[model samples]
Target: MNYSPELVQFLGSLVAILAVAGLAWWMKLGGAPELSNEKEAQAAASEAMDGFESVETAVDANGRGAILRDRSGCLLLLKQHGNKFAGRLLTHSATGRIDKDKLVVDSGERRFGVVALAIDHAQSWADRINEVRSASDA
Candidate 1:
């Protein structure tokens, strides 16, 4: 068969376009797994925190203690060094105590010794957490 030069160039261009489109499609499909994984993680987190009217967790920068507070105003103060989240309910404490009075939450793992700093920073960070939860719920 004899092919015209113009026809040959057109077909070559068409093939190149299709190849690029196929690659794009492949990449899009490949990203689906990551999306699904993130969805699953979000779902799990939601479920875990479900049934609580409003919940907030604050951890010290050193990861020593965490306070889990529910909508009812009840708070659970957890302390850990090697024990990890084990602590008695602190019934009495001095007012404005900076060392262990407040709860602080940090994103990454680090040794946080003072719960006061965590509590001081909690309001801003918790606002962000609430925003994320709201968006994820939607």
Candidate 2:
């Protein structure tokens, strides 16, 4: 079959574009990194939750998001979406509980998302959040 030059060029460009797109998806080019250290986790938290004056404690949720408590008894949930971070401030009414290895933060009416960190200290985060929540109540 004889192929026109225009068709050939168009096919080549399409293939190139597909290849680039595949590479980006494979490498997660604009995704959040799996935080392995406190500093990196803090940076991700800061980027995800702006205006966080100071971070008292932080935990990574398998690179998906972070559970952070600020100095002022604020529980912040930072979820990474593509290259951007979506943040939610868990109010004092929000209750925290651990189901298996995941810490579920929920309120009576609405529920916040869950963070699945590979760390072994899921309970620690839940406890801290509960402590802060209770403190604010008192």
Candidate 3:
């Protein structure tokens, strides 16, 4: 059977699109990652950054994110970035506020923006974040 040039071009484009989509699905390149437990959060944090050892971890109630604390009392925020997770070491400049069970944190990097996590003891985490700021000022 003979086909027109336009028909051939359309088929070629369709194949390319399907191939790309298949590759993305196979690689899990666009799924929302969640932390199912403290161990998983710690692992993701360590993978996102070098030399991060989480001594304490608080996974979000819904598993949307987590807050990890290293032995040195440094806080790390782990959140979904595309299909993977991104960890940001909460600097002294980082700040957080609590709303009952919710803790909203600002990384202080304008681009990184803010994140609100629902975890146990949100008030304590917010207080701990404040201590980070105070310690820096001291």
For each candidate, what TM-score against the reference?
A: 0.31, 0.56, 0.77
Provide the lDDT at 120 for model 1: 46
For model 3, name the residue pairs that clash: none
How many pairs of residues in model 3 come into backbone collision? Answer: 0
RMSD of each candidate relative to the true structure: 18.1, 6.7, 5.5
* lDDT of the structure predicted as candidate 2: 0.66
Screening candidate 1 with a backbone cut-off below 3 angstroms (N, C-alpha, C), the clashing residue pairs are 59-104, 61-112, 62-111, 62-112, 103-119, 104-118
TM-score of 3: 0.77
Q: What tens-digit string does per-residue lDDT give for candidate 2 at 42-85?
A: 67667766767546545554666667777776777765665666
lDDT against the true structure, each candidate: 0.43, 0.66, 0.87
User: What total of clashing residue pairs does each candidate reach?
Assistant: 6, 0, 0
Best by lDDT: 3
Candidate 2's TM-score = 0.56
Residue ranges of candidate 2 with Cα displaced over 4 Å: 1-32, 107-112, 131-138
- TM-score, cand. 1 vs. native: 0.31
Residues 1-138 of candidate 1: C-alpha lDDT, one tens digit per residue: 999999999999999999998998877743311112323323323344454332655545544444555566433344443422333222222111223444343322234333343444555544443444455467
| Residue 10, model 3: Cα distance from true site in angstroms | 20
- lDDT per residue for candidate 3 within 1-138, as digits (tens), equals 999999999999999999999998998777777789998988898897888998989998878789999988889998777768887988888999976669999988888878889998898998998899998999
| Candidate 1 deviation (Cα RMSD) | 18.1
Best by TM-score: 3
Better of 1 and 3 by lDDT: 3
